[model samples]
Target: MKPQHLLAAATLVLATTAFAAGDPHDHAHAHTPLHGGVVVEVKDIDYELVAQPSVIQLHLRDHGKPADVSNATARLTLLTGTEKQEVVLKPAGDKLEATGSFKVAPGSKAVAVVTVAGKPSTVRFVLK
Candidate 1:
């Protein structure tokens, strides 16, 4: 085989191996939200954040089963441009609920800190 042909084949093998090793879009998966909100997975738990004008709700599901939030406590930070607000959430049945006058704009972001059974977890969401 020619030297140039051998080099080209070696380069092709390396490029193929590198592409197969890592995929940048591996995290992009189809997730259907049970509640009408943004869902993020944290520590094998799926947390759905529903933010309205004056109410914020966090719903949790474990492997498609509703997880209890009865003894869980949560704090939500809302960021809209230069404005920032925080809300504390308490257990309300199967989910955590917080009510306040929050400015959740289109480009806003939300970070949730939840402690369930004394274990802390964090979830993040970008408002649409």
Candidate 2:
């Protein structure tokens, strides 16, 4: 195409990215959860943050094995940028919920040490 058309297209793309980057309304799909185990990934997790029951702040997966996380004995390592904290995890219904303690600050990274049956396991979650 012409140079002017190319410039206009480039300008349009930059404008769109800038708009998406700076606007809070563009927070679509940001609330989606990321479920993974055996490897740490940056995704939303379905773990509760402390005992709020309203906010879950943990990352874990069943791994589809009876030998993995079958008994539920885990610890959630919370990291708020520079600050670090730990939350105990217990079997709450079908999910592993943090025990009554601290409210997991939003946007904090979480690393978990889960002990299932008699085996120790690990997983990490990057805050949504």
Candidate 3:
């Protein structure tokens, strides 16, 4: 093969190899809700929000393992049509929970801001 053809072939091989390697931070795992709630994944962490009429719960998990939320706090904003409600959740047992009247319904949306050890992460959910 000619010198130019040889260099082009080498470049093509390296590019193909790099593409096949894929991303190191890519998490292609399934996120199934443990509490029968809406689950969202952020930065490899899963946040499940179980919104009920009388209580709200936010569960955190990292790679299928329960994440530590003992020093964490969460604030949720729930929107159901024209009605909006906000609630603050404290760490309770293995999850963050709050007890109060909430307007959670089908097709409702929620935005949770969870802070753990001074770092905060936000997760959005749509109730079904």
Q: How accurate locally is residue 107 in candidate 2, as Cα lDDT from 0 to 100?
A: 66
Better of 2 and 3 by TM-score: 3
Runs with alpha carbons beyond 4 Å of true place in candidate 2: 1-70, 99-106
- Each candidate structure's TM-score, on Cα atoms with residue i matched to residue i, is 0.78, 0.47, 0.79
Clash pairs (backbone) in predicted model 3: none
Q: After superposition, how far is residue 117 of candidate 1 from its true place, in Å?
A: 0.8
Could you tell me the TM-score of candidate 2? 0.47
Residue 31, model 2: lDDT of: 35
Best by lDDT: 3
Candidate 3 structure, TM-score to reference: 0.79
lDDT of 3 by residue, 54-128 (tens): 989999998888999999999999999999998999999999999989998999999999998899998999999
lDDT at 18, model 3: 94
In terms of lDDT, which candidate is stronger, 1 or 2?
Answer: 1
Q: How many backbone clashes does candidate 2 have?
A: 7
Q: Write one digit per residue (lDDT tens) for candidate 1, span 44-96.
A: 78899888999899999886788988999998889999999989999888899
Instruction: Find the 10 residues in a row with the least total lDDT in model 2.
Output: 36-45
